[model samples]
Target: MDTYRTGDEGRAAQETSFRAHIAIAKRYGKPLVIHDRDAHADVLRVLDDEGAPDTVVLHCFSGDADFAAECVRRGHLLSFAGTVTFANAVALRDAARVTPIKQMLVETDAPYLTPMPFRGRPNASYLIPLTVRHLAEATGADLDELCAAISATGDRVFGPW
Candidate 1:
């Protein structure tokens, strides 16, 4: 249920589809993965209107600390991508700090948003460790502990591999 902001012309259609997907996710008892891009308030409103699923994941989370806290309070998992490793992502790092290890996940955002040293290059799954390392630093969690927590959270959210 990733509700994208497709501009004014397609807003209605996008929202309608988002609502339908949310409904389907709820009916099937599946986790909802949200990819919000500058439409944070509306996304939360729609989720509230439709009632969020038991398991909600904010994929490549782009919100600030307050928004992260709100999502955390709602029991949503915040998945951080390589963007969080950027030097300019102070707010994102702050959000990560507030998020509990159990509620946090790491991603590569592959083909884009590569971590600092590889910023100009295409991202890949292999670059995930760089993001994880940054997350560990940003959130002040031990590297091994964060990795273990991420693994457990993955199992809880999507079942074992």
Candidate 2:
């Protein structure tokens, strides 16, 4: 088989792997939970090309408002993590501001990306409140309401626990 890799070898490998992953998600009718650290643009492009799953989530989303708006426009979900609470995460905070409650999710990303005041410390699901609280504050939504909405969205996307 003839192969033509573009850009760089790593990029080509990622594309190939993403294609396979999309296919599997389609086959199983499952939502895709993505961990996007610094590849928002490429990930968006690939999803656009391959047609995103019925429910696609950008877990630990790390993008600016533009990316968040694009994800909202594309009907993809964004799961906010401890990064949102980082004092230096201006862009991420901006993204959270633009991310509506209905399209929002909250996660701990435990053992890593722990929220400030507890940075570089052990983390667990209990730490979700810190992230969620920050998200609520950033989005200007009521804490209880935001949590409920996130829970509902999670159930909708993952089909319940």
Candidate 3:
């Protein structure tokens, strides 16, 4: 489609879109939930140039340890999903280990990225425990403690319900 074009037109529009979103979030004092797949560098660049909101959550973070560290340094939150528990997610696990517990949050990303046992099928909110448990194990943090941290951080990022 139009977004799939390789020329400068689409690229400019994409950049403009990001800038506008960032600007609106900044002006309104709203937290940003970033969905960055393989565009970690581009997303970070935009955030850096446009100035990120006070709180930025990298939803379903897919970067390496170094990128994770950078996000932490920049004071952004990193939310991990079921992919961190995948057999081939060594890099993702590594990132989780190094990310401070206070700066991390667990998510199910329901209807997608189902945890190991439930893979190849649709995921639901009830499956969050599976992801949270994996995150605790990977981070070497006590299960209860990790759960508490995730809960607290999520509340702060999205506001308490």
Give the TM-scores of the predictions, in the order they appear: 0.95, 0.91, 0.92
Better of 1 and 2 by TM-score: 1
Q: What TM-score would candidate 2 get against the native?
A: 0.91
Candidate 1 Cα misplacement greater than 4 A, ranges: 1-5
In model 2, residue pairs whose N, Cα or C atoms come closer than 3 Å (at least 3 residues apart or on different chains), thus clashing, are none
Worst 10 residues of 3 by lDDT: 1-10
* Model with the higher lDDT, candidate 1 or 3: 1
State each model's C-alpha RMSD to the native.
Answer: 1.6, 4.3, 2.6
* 49-152 per-residue lDDT for model 3 (tens digits): 98898999998888899999999999889999888879999999999988999999877787899998888798788988988889888888999998888889
| Span of ten consecutive residues with least summed lDDT in model 2 | 1-10
- Candidate 2: lDDT over CA atoms? 0.83
By lDDT: ranked, best first: 1, 3, 2
User: What are the per-model numbers of colliding residue pairs?
Assistant: 0, 0, 0
Tens-digit lDDT track of model 2 for 42-133: 78778889888888888888789999999998898998888888899999889988888999998887788898778899877888888888
TM match of model 3 to true structure: 0.92
